[model samples]
Target: MKPPPFSYHRAGSGEHAVALLSALGPRAKVLAGGQSLLPMLNLRLADPPHLVDIGRAEDLRILRRAGDRLVIGAATTQSEVEYSSLTAAVPLLAEAVGYVAHPPIRHRGTVVGSMAHAAAVAELPCVALVLDARFTVLGADGVRTVAAGDFFLGPFRTAVGPGELVAEVALPIAAPGTGQAWSEFSLRRGNFPVAGAGVSLTLHHGRVAAVAIGLSGVADRPVRVPSAERILLGAVPDDELITRAAAAATEDLEPRPAADPAAHILPVPVAPVPGFDYRARVARSQVRRALTTALARAGGTR
Candidate 1:
């Protein structure tokens, strides 16, 4: 497939990129690592009139820690974030990054690009949701912060305006006794998960303290299962409790079977509209696996 013709510009700085985008308006698109966008271009899914390449914008390639929070420049690559010293402080994010595609893909894929791409099926964004990460966006009106929960509005879509560029992401330091686990189930190695969960919990006085469960590939957006989190709060981890939590986590998903009528002959669940009911079932299974792993890491039931 060939992409539609477009003008190209390489920005010297983040500010320059923003200005160019602002001036170009709706016809312009920003290029980071070209991991996701380039594919769209190849398929003619996106035919923007101009392409602004910010790959050489040095400021967006750095990672730093500011006071109590860790700041990641939007253009920072997945490989950089995975091996960063600061990311080591946040084990969940680090582990998740290690699992993001293969090494080759990670080398060229930028973290901010993935977030801005807003693929509902991605894992890191779900972790971002669990950690309450905040995104910094630069626009003509200056800068503003948007919470991860609010930033991702739908599949491959975000709250970023026409000219706004995501500058960085801010994550708060985890409280003491806090542990996190990220796990997923994929049909093949290195493939995106069919369903996944990121669990963060704080242990207080020998009891469940705070819990945040973020799920992916089970809905239109990364969903936080508050009901399941609430169940684990102040309670002990047990088989029955985990089961109940898994159900809660998948309660809203409606997994349907495959669309091809002939696919039903494969002896697998199939349904319409992604089979929300059946997807929820698969989601339930994965949630249980994730919760068990998370509990074990948190020292297993007090």
Candidate 2:
């Protein structure tokens, strides 16, 4: 399939890209990695009249540490984030990036693009939620920051308005005693996961001091399981506690309609969404598995 007829506009920098967007209004689409945008265009899922290319945006290629946050530019590919020294700061993101399809895709897909293109069914957005990542948006109105929780509205949807483009994503550095783990259910590596979990846990004195649970393929968007986190806080992570927490995680899953669960991704299809009971069961199990691994990494027993 081919994309709809469109006018191509090239921007030399991030600011230039924003200016183009302002002029084109919502009819223009910004092109960075083009991994997701091109596919959507080919499928006619996105029919914008203008394509604003930002590939030449040098300032938007930044990857650096701004104090405690590891900042990644909109043009920063997944490969760059995966291999960069800055990855050490957000281990969960680093670990999850490996599960984002194959190296070839990673080499071309921008981390911010994936975050903007995806909801909960993909990897980066889920990791964004778990790490409390922040997105910087630039527009004619000026700049504004959006938290991951508020940024992800749904699949291929985000807080970025028509004239605003996401310039960068910033992730908080993991504190001492923090341990991260990622898990996904797929018949093969690089395939869209049937379900997945990303966990960040901090243990102190054998008890959970802090934890964040990010779940994918369980709902319309990547989400944090606060109820599950509450179950583990200040408690020794054991078989019993983990079991209880995992069950709590299930309470938060709102499965897609039974008739067409795959419709959540629209032009793209994911693993068939299972029955409500099955999804709840898988969510519980994955949370248990991730928490167990995270606890071990945090130097906790069981």
Relative to the unseen true structure, what is the Cα RMSD of model 2? 1.8
Please give the lDDT score for candidate 2: 0.83
> Candidate 2 residues 129-233, lDDT tens each?
998999999999999999998998876678898988999999999888988888877658996666788899998888889999988877777889999999899
CA lDDT, candidate 2, residue 84: 95
Compared with the true structure, all predictions reach lDDT values of 0.78, 0.83
Segments of candidate 2 deviating more than 4 angstroms: 258-276
Error of 2 at 168 (Å): 0.5
lDDT of 1: 0.78
